[model samples]
Target: MRVRQMAAPLGAIVEDLDVRAVDASTAKELNRLFCQHHVLVFPKQQLTPDEQIAFAEHWGELIPFPYGSLPGYPNIIELRNRGKARDVNQHWHSDMTYDPTPPKLTMLYALEAPAIGGETAFANQILAYQELSAGMKKLVGSLVATHSAKDLARLYGQDPDQASEAEHPVVRTHDESGEKALYVCRAFTRQFQDWSRQESKALLDYLYEHCVRPEYQARHQWQAGDLVMWDNRCLLHYAVHDHGEDPRLIHRLQVQGTSPV
Candidate 1:
């Protein structure tokens, strides 16, 4: 398989490879590419839930998707929508951060896609941290941010307090590469762990804005039979919600991860 960088921030597209039958050496190289590139896009491919799970296992242990899954497979989350105004994926964030151990990687396989605008965007958080002023970096290194499903529930008109919450380092280190990345996001991250909400607002907001700089992003427009996945450890993604009444179906799965240090 040949790997090519997508654009400015960080992403790679792997061409001329069949996803279903990756060999041991190929799997090792793909995993290495995943760490180096962050997002790996394998276009023009078809896969069943079983096939997707089989391919995913080569990278890491599969984790349960909290909401629900495809009928037979407990490891896969089915994303089928005609579009809605109050979309959960509208904001930029990592997945399931409220959990003590959030997902290490997330994969999405497109079965049906919109013809127009329903692009998923990703940001390189490592770049975000590296570009910050030295003082800002030092301050963030000393802090931990609150990430909660409660904040997400509020956005979807649900009982906010009933949702889960956890605290993770504002700057997390990559397990494989030993690189630091800004971890706070607008969707799940609430505020600094020990500070009052009011006191944490300004700083968190600045980080929320800073982390999504255009230079650190890459947009993927979907197509049927496209498989895309990202490293949740060092990147954040936003699912765009502009495609109205268009049928979009994507199968999702994530791998278990340790708590960010």
Candidate 2:
């Protein structure tokens, strides 16, 4: 497998690695690479739903999206917002934090794209955690936080009545490498547990700001057949909406994982 760095800190374009069909050995190596790199981008991989799901299964169990399936295929999550709808991932977030066991890995396959923009940006949460002071790390290590869709909906100008929250460790250790990451994001992380409302807000806001520093991020521009897989546990991502008239469509598959911590 050939891996090319897209940006200095986070992104990589993995070429020559065949995702269409893989041997057991290659699949194991790919999983290891994914853990180290955080984000792996396939420049031009055209895969059907079955192919995508099959490839995802090589690493872990597939997690069905909460909102049902794609239009034609009810199994895949349609990550498109064209014409009237437009792309909705304008902010940084880890997917499905509302669930007790949020998806550990999220794979997105590009179907269509515009000439410019719609690039996805990823931040290295592990790096974010590593950059903290020893004192701050000790303080955060003893804490836990609540992640909720209700908090996210409110940020998106939607009501929070339908959303639910899950408690996750403030500092999560990666299943494979045992690397600790700051398990927080702007989307679902409401506040630190054991802190008052005011204290929670201040602490969460500080952590969120620190995790998204520019030096720890990489942005990937899309190609029609590109397939990207990211570790949702140790990274945060944002989809940019730079395309105006043009449209972009993608299919997403998620991998099941234990709750944070």
Candidate 3:
């Protein structure tokens, strides 16, 4: 298969590969490519729900979306933002970190996109982790942080205190590559468990600020038929809400994963 870099830093487009019939070897190679590239974009590709699930299975088992089931397929998650509806992924996050096994890889197939701006931004958490000061790394490495949907719930007008939260390693080793990554994000990471409220806020604010440095990021401008797959273990993503009157619709399939090993 032919691969072309989208830009200098992060994304790549794989050409001449059939999405429907990816073989085991190809899938393994793709997984390696995904780790190296962080984001893989397939342009002008169309997939049925079954096809999407099947394609996702080439990498690993399909994990259902966090909120609920899709309209037609009870397993798939509809990632759509209607003009009247509230956008779900407005902040930077890794999917479903509150769960025991968060999604390893997330695959999003775009059905619709605005003519103008609705680009997705990805930050390389591995790079973010690697670049931390020696003292900062040691400080964070010694602590475990709580990741929750509570803050996001509050932002969406839901009760923040009622949402689920979990303590995870601040610097987690990726199961596949054994590379360390900063596993914190603004949306889900509530606090460092060992710290007091004031201390937690201060440390978390510092981490969130460091995790999003421009040098570690790449922005993806969606095409209507683009299928984007990303390694959730090593990346944090943000969806830009630039679409005004028009709607943006995406269907996402996540791969089942274990806790960071």
- Per-residue alpha-carbon lDDT of model 3 for 109-206, expressed as tens digits? 99998887888998889889999999999998888888887656765577776777788888999887888999987777877886886898898888
Residue ranges of candidate 2 with Cα displaced over 4 Å:
83-88, 151-159
How big is the positional error of residue 205 in model 1, measured in Å on the Cα after superposition? 0.8
Give the C-alpha lDDT of model 2: 0.83
Q: Give the TM-score of candidate 2.
A: 0.92
* Per-residue lDDT of candidate 2, residues 1-261 (tens digit): 797777777666789866887878888888877888889888778798889988888878887875558776555888665653332356688888778999999999999977888788999989999999999999999998887787556655777787777888889999888999988877777777878878998888888899999999988888899999999889999887777668888899899988777
The positional error of residue 46 in candidate 1, measured at the CA in angstroms, is: 1.5
| CA lDDT scores, all candidates in order | 0.89, 0.83, 0.82
- Model 3 has an lDDT value of 0.82
Error at 198, model 3, angstroms: 1.1
Please report the TM-score between candidate 3 and the true structure: 0.93
Give the candidate number with the greatest TM-score.
1
lDDT of 2 at 31: 80
Rank candidates by TM-score, best first. Answer: 1, 3, 2
Off by over 4 Å in 3: 84-88, 152-162
Off-target runs (Cα >4 Å) in candidate 1 are 153-159
Residue 194 of model 1 has an lDDT of 83
